[model samples]
Target chain A: MSTITLIGAGQMASALTFPLYENGHEVRLVGSPLDDQVIDRLREDNYHVNLLRTLHDGIHYYKESEKEAAIQGADLIVCGVSSFGVDWFADKILPILDESVPVISVTKGMLDYEDGTMQTYPEYWMSKLPEGSKQEIYAIGGPCTARDLADHDPSFVGYCGPKMETLHWIRSLFATDYYVISLTLDVVGLECAVALKNGYALGTALAIGMAEKAGDDGINHNNSEAALFQESVKEMLDLLKIVGGGVDNIMYAAGDLNVTVAAGRSRTVGLLLGKGLSIDEVMEQLKGQTLEAVVIATRTARAVKALAKAGKVKESDFPLLMHVNALLNEGATLNIPWTDFQKEM
Target chain B: MSTITLIGAGQMASALTFPLYENGHEVRLVGSPLDDQVIDRLREDNYHVNLLRTLHDGIHYYKESEKEAAIQGADLIVCGVSSFGVDWFADKILPILDESVPVISVTKGMLDYEDGTMQTYPEYWMSKLPEGSKQEIYAIGGPCTARDLADHDPSFVGYCGPKMETLHWIRSLFATDYYVISLTLDVVGLECAVALKNGYALGTALAIGMAEKAGDDGINHNNSEAALFQESVKEMLDLLKIVGGGVDNIMYAAGDLNVTVAAGRSRTVGLLLGKGLSIDEVMEQLKGQTLEAVVIATRTARAVKALAKAGKVKESDFPLLMHVNALLNEGATLNIPWTDFQKEM
Candidate 1:
């Protein structure tokens, strides 16, 4: 068995350690600087507070202080950090000398510029390296939730790397019957497709909150959710087209959007918004919680604004995203512009 | 005000009377020959037992005996019959002297042949008419549910016909602030796209049933649902492509499938299956309840088998549909063939 170094102890990273461990791989789950408490819990009783489950017993936990020792790994490295920990990983982990190992990340966010351009995390990380550096980071995106993955519920994900071998190697390393991996070379498309799912998922969850606020009694407002979900996918396909992703990738985006809308931290945020809680109130309430939808919505709106200023894209192109951006940023009310979401389809 | 004749007095037909009354149209809700009891309730208490709501006072209710009067001076005719009543409609209602009236149908099903061919209900109806019959039946499909429509939830639907005038006329008669109508000219594509939703919707609801059987405690298994949703769409697109439907129509299919999965009669049946109830058990449980998903799943399997016999399409192209068919028709177990669903993305 090869050594697989997982560089974060967060929910997704921790959950993924199961499949890797199940495949008999030596998984070194190195906690980030912020994960000291989690690392202590793991080392103490193998319990993950956030996941609310005991992890595999064979997993070797490492504190952030053991970076150099963890960095001298042999076979593969998985960047398990959240989008927030990316910079820390870059500053501390990237400076190590083992440059020949293959790296794949579970992070699902993008980097945008004021000039209205977007890059996947891998692209952004690759740009940070020396011009001739051969280090390539693979991309992963799909509907696999951490709890369900740990539960061994059937999950499908996509992995895109520099080559087919990179993908197949990853499949061989971590693929299980339940954790299905689909490989493609269009990393940017997969990244863009999945990143867009978060904001739109928040958009779809608006209905559940609205229903709760109205005191639903054994009935639902799923027609509204279905329309919103459809709008979300249409807008997501728009971004996928813009980012050079294929139409085939919409399945992945659909899967991600479906799960995010169904349950998760993002669903909670979306439900609160729909329940008429103001952005400030939600922010105050969910302090320190990782609101990826909020981050993505605000950033995507910023990028769209810059692009619209340059006449590269129109503001009305993403009415749902624009409306969510308004809710989270401009202090707009919970009124959705349903009429604006139509264009003859 | 133009006269709008809605035949069959069913849930959808009854629901549409609200919009027509809102628009000040003279609505004639004619109960089909089978709807005598419903008409009796409507006349007695102004209540529809099925919709469980009192309809508007403005709608002129017509019994089956008044069929001749209802057809005399209608500006439009809406074929509100289910797929089962299509033949009765053709035999009894198509003979009326209403040659110039525009017709639209809220029915979302198709007619397939043993020769591996499929025709939409409208096309099948047209085939039986006189060779030079100029009457064109417009198509409607989207995520609309009867209760949601009665609640005036924001619903988006596509109206595709032989001409734009037919769609616009229907839109004029029905469009409201909450009921959004998207117009297109791809009638065949819209029909094929929508007809495929019921069966796939059943496929997506398997996870919900499976969860119920496992006695989930404050937990979800949406990852499975999301994967099934993705698979359902992929297979729906396959049917759309085969039936000359465009991929652009997938949002309608997605919207329809999403609603069916979340909450509905079909979702109930799927849940029973997932909860370890056999097909016979589900059949006995919901004695008179409408099982559209079951009907569609069985018919789709029949057509697929015929097609496969002629080498028109492979049965594996629709693993989910075929599996559901086996469960409902062949007494197969509830085990979903998840591994048979993989192909390169």
Candidate 2:
């Protein structure tokens, strides 16, 4: 059995070990320096507190200090760290990784380059690797939640990168009957779509919140949500196209984003905001919570606005994105100018 | 004030009178031949028993026998009849309708032409009207529920027709601050999108039903629903393109369809079918209730299958459509072949 090194002990990383372990792979789950306590818990109990279950016996735990030992002879390396940690992980692991070993990223976010161009997580990671490195890099995205993956509920995800030939082996390494993986070479589209979803989810959550506050008894806000969903998708597709990604990737992006919003967090934040709570009040309500939507919304909006200023993207092309960005970053109100929305994308 | 004649006494028609009456238009809500009892109720109580609320006092009710008088001097005529009644209404009213009076259809469905062509309701109505009649036909579509409209909840709908100039007056005539309207020239796409939504809603309903039966407690089936939704939109876009409509129209179609599925009827039928009730059992359970999704799913599937045979459309292009059709017409089990779904679409 091949040994797979997963460099992160977060929820996604923990959830991912199930599929690899179930596929008869030896899993080395190395926790970040910040995850020493989690590593201790895993070593003692073989359980992930976040997942609320004991991991399979096939898993081996490693602390951040054991990085080189964990990566030295692994068949494949996977990075499941949060987007913010990609650069740090790259700096730590790239020098030690074998040039022959391929890397697959489960991280979804955008990176702003020094040149002011926005790069996806996979792109950013690949750029940080040693020059002339033959190792292929791929990104995984779609509606597969960490909890659902852990539960062995049927999950579908997209594997995307420039190296199409490498995906079959990657697919075989992780895919179970319940964990289905579809392949695409549209890496830019897939990564951008995944990163931008959190921002869009915030917009939809606001609509949900407004519907709840409107107090139409027994009438669900599905209509408003659907409208917001369509608009969000349109804006996403437009932004993707502007950033040199395929519009076709919208299918996967829309599906994944919809699922994410429906399952809470982003929507929960939006619901509170939509109920007429100010940003400060909502943040107080969600005190001590790491709201990914807020983080991504602020960052992606900044990146897009920068792109717009450089004439690489048009501001008018993305009214919803601008409104959402303003709402999150500039303390703008939750009033979405639905009338100014373009009918065609 | 402009005199407007709405020639259907159904829920949508009844709901629509609120806007017209509120806008100070002289509204003549004429019942079809089948709506004798509804007309009697409206005349007696000025309330739609189905809506559980009284209509504004300004509306003028007309019996089925008063069709000629209702249409004689109307500034505009709107048909809110169900799909099944479109042909019957066209036969009755086409001869009496003035050539100068524009018609707006709130009916959403398709008609099978004798030559094996499928025409949207607006097209079917326009085709049946007197040649050289010069009457502009438009369609109103979106996530507008009759109950919501009657309750004066904020609603947004699209007005689509070839006559761009006519939309201004149409918008002004119907749009309240709460009842918003957008305009498009893609009448074919709008009508087809609205009609086909029922069929797609059935597919999504089945997904929801299956998710509910799978019993993954606390895990919202939003992922499954989202996947199904994306597939539905792809099939819709493909079909719309094949039928000489814009794929851009997918925005409105997706929004309307999502809203429709989430808020009952179609989903109810799907849920029951998903719960292992045979088609016959579900029908028996509903008794004499009119299930629009069931009617549309059977018809749309038949139409698509016929198109597939004629090389007009590819059967492989629409797996969800084919599967739903099989489930409804062939008594097939609720087996969704998710793996076989096209990744790009």
Candidate 3:
């Protein structure tokens, strides 16, 4: 029975709060400038964030203003807010928190609002904290989805921190038979991993939609659709390297787990777009787009740009990353031709 | 029941034969020299092709030498041989046959060994006949694999002919509950459709492998692997367009079906390679490797070059095709950076 404080009432915040509560942990949920309806809904639903029809329990909801007070005695502080809210929460909550409280990030990516890998979301947030603050931040990622988890779908999620103990603690905090969790101490590796996965997810959705429209009336392969999917995986894996992920990690992404993951928010969002729904109107249709992978890809693309500029990343990965970034932001309409990349490959 | 004669007894031949047999059609099987053992095994086992405990019945197996006599009265003569054997069989068999015979080509591509297409395959094969002789050739394709069909794994298979009656006849003859067969008279479109699917598949395997090998650390997403897969799909769609595949087809290739399909094959091959197996060893280990997309990518690269020289394919597609060709033959290495691309997005 650990007390967990989650800062944010956004889609991700609700997602984390409900699950932690259901797992028998006491959770304090906080959101920035949080609306009364969201708070009312959280309280009425018992911290339940319903998606595909499952309810999660045990959350004590609060506004962001109450975070410091609410988190005072908490064993763990998790930030499940969007990338923009990291600084606001860190500034207000860190000063009042106990020094030893382990913090876990249920969010999927680094903030993309700036330049340099040093400017990534968590790194930027941690930089403002006291010197030893880096050890407190950890990230949880992988194929798990908010909608699915909200629906109580049996799923796999991964958490990575600098220390094995921190990771283990997080695993224990989030673990359940229905929600299988794994731990790793590769903090630097994990942040980008989730981000890349998100980007790939969004990009894949676009690519698949495009291929379905194209069919098998091409000059080369009999079914260009099959060729497109096959090649899309390969392209995603390559971009993974440029962004600082390992090949083994991509094996999982390009593997069934990530591929099988339902992109609920992205799918709905894309479908709305396909059906001629404007983004703003579609944004009003339901909750915000919580596909962390897309957000992460955008952020990591910035980080990779910083890495490349600093001479940390190789020059060769430039064009590939450029193509991916374009797709992540504008959708997958601008992938480079492999034939254009023979020498590089 | 319609009498169907299947030519060639390799993996594809065996795969194509079972579905027809399972549909309760009486199939007369003919094999190349290399397929003697395959024929004997099917005969000894009472004509069964087993894939992971799913058994399919195989009926009437024979050697290529016996095809002439066996196929004499067959209503539909379907050939599933490698692109290499089209000429040999056409010359030997088409001559002795009646002009009214309808032939269905299960091969998605032309034999580079002899120039062929929906136009050329029939034109060349029928040209040798007496001046007044006439024969109809139909081409069929879809995403279905024989191995999957043998195991009764439900999937879509398609057939196309020059005439509606011919297509309807083929579809009716081949359709079954387990196999969903669609018929079309867009023979030219169908020929290229199946052929282009290979490019997307091969490009996917190559790109994902590279990304995974380069930097996607056991994390699946925004890292290098996702980027690469994303990029590869974009590139494939671009190339598909340049090479004559419709833009609409790109979505299907990028979709879940294509992603799942490629992920399975790429992971299998990649895992084998990662486990220190040679490419040939990996190829040998999987029976489905025969239809492996890379073979078609390479073949298309060859065809692109040929078409470029003859001014048949688009000029823009030529350069990209040339580049892919180089990559396939050279086995080049890629070390792309993510930083530059992030800025572009």
Candidate 4:
């Protein structure tokens, strides 16, 4: 069995850990060195998935200092840490990882640095890797949520990276009856897919809630949704392309994720909005929870706006994107009222 | 039991028949003199929805001549006929029915001859009535589809007219455990809601399908749907105001008819599209099925376009509305790839 060491025990890390364990890997999970509650849960669940499936006896958990020893002889080093924690891990963990060992990142979004040139976790990690070790860092992406898989309905999605072998290794490690079809290779494409998909899914959730409140018959009319879907996909694809990703990113982003309707975290926010719950109430609920699609969409809008202002992207894409951001963050009030708008519809 | 004569056995007629009969109304189902399976089924069932629910012994069926006689002393003349047939009925049936018989129409869209006026079936019927008989016609609208009611899940919508008594009668005859909440009055407002909601639903469906195809997650990005939903509702409401409809029409259209994300037929089409069914295939399956929202959206787009061309509406609203029509018809395929355009999603 391949020895697998994963950094971060947040949502994505939790989501990734189960698949790796299921595929018969000797897995080691490490969360924040700071949060006692997070580390405690990781320590408890490190041996198994609680309330869902059986746990692997070979699985282990570690503190940050113990992470180096955990990965000392590992075949794979997978990082599912947040964007904010990448620098900390890069400095602390990279030094201990073997020079030949490959690292795969499940994190999306840019580092909130002034330059914004550094877009993803893999990019940041690759930069820190010793000179010729550039090809060792890969980005893993697709439509995946830990809650959905834990519930056991079959869900299919795509995953890609620049290295075909690394992609295949990751795909082979996660492919199962519950989670199927992970494509190997195309890092930029898959990265764009996951990043943009998160935003779009949140948007759909927000709209569904608004449509419900406005009493819209939730049916497709005049191809209204089709246009929005297409235009939004295109805009995200174009923006990603301009930002150094490929057009294929659009395909993975649009098709692979089975989250056409919102569920879990996004749905919770949407339902709260439907009940007229304010953003403050939502924030309160979200405290200490891993950042969700709603949070991601807001971050994306800010990132895109910055990109547009830097003259790296088209100015026209901002308004719609901004409006979408407002819909998710500020709630339906930021959107046009149902009755006032339905007249035009 | 009060005698209720319904003229039409189309989708809407078939849908409404069950509830009226179940509520203990002596419903006389009437249709055009044609040899059709649905008509045959209605006759055999005695206009009963027994196959759908429990058999209703109170319901009856009749020919056109029998309908005229049935309506002579009927408590209500409820028409669920097609838009094209409304005039024919107005010419033939209205003359024979007693002037005191109040009518409620479920048909939407304007009469072909009265293209300039945004008149619905009730309005067309009123115009043909003798002096002071205008008050006899009313309408029930918003997104209560026949399929939903036939499935037995409760569907709530709105009923409106100029008279409070007429609105009350419409609500009393229609409302049931399976059907609830018919917000009272304002015929003009009801018509505006009906027309606009249908058009916008179609637009929303197409956009959802397009986004799925374009490889973008349809979740929360841009809440593009919020824009479509809000803008389309506004357009419909404003048009109603500009052309003269009750303020209540906007509320009903924008509030009561909103389809649940799971319940919307158009969303089903989009989901099928995501599952790799072509639009043509979808249309074929939907052949002979009544998709009122889709039909009305198309009709609404045509009406809006014509109004725009005639300089009766503002040019500013043309892009989104016109684009909605184009997407519904064949989608914006100009320079887009066939795979991108024709992707089952």
lDDT string, candidate 1, B179-252, tens digits: 87778888878888788888888888888888877784645787888888888887887788778877778778
Across residues A234-276, which tens digit of lDDT does each residue of candidate 2 receive? 6777777767887667766676776777775787887887787
Q: Give the TM-score of candidate 4.
A: 0.50
Give the DockQ (2 decimals) of all models. Answer: 0.61, 0.40, 0.04, 0.03
Q: With candidate 2 superimposed using the best TM-score fit, by how many Å does residue B218's alpha carbon deviate from the native?
A: 5.1
Best by lDDT: 1
Question: Which one wins on TM-score?
Answer: 1
Ranking by DockQ: 1, 2, 3, 4
Docking quality class, candidate 3: incorrect
Chain A accuracy of model 2 expressed as TM-score: 0.94
Every candidate's CA RMSD: 2.0, 2.8, 17.1, 15.0
The candidate that achieves the highest DockQ relative to the unseen native structure: 1
Interface RMSD of each: 1.6, 2.9, 14.2, 14.3
Candidate 2 chain A: minimum summed lDDT over ten consecutive residues — where? A336-345
lDDT of 1 at B161: 84
Candidate 4 lDDT, A1-345, residue by residue in tens: 788888876556665666678778888877657534565654675433332333444568777666767777888778777666778778887777786778777776554344334266666677787777644777655445554454433344555556666666666777665565445555655675566656555543554454455465533231222223333444565556656765444434544222433344555564455445566676697786554566566767777667667887655544445665776665545442221111111
TM-score of the first chain alone, every candidate: 0.97, 0.94, 0.76, 0.78
DockQ of 4: 0.03
TM-score of chain B of each: 0.97, 0.95, 0.73, 0.77
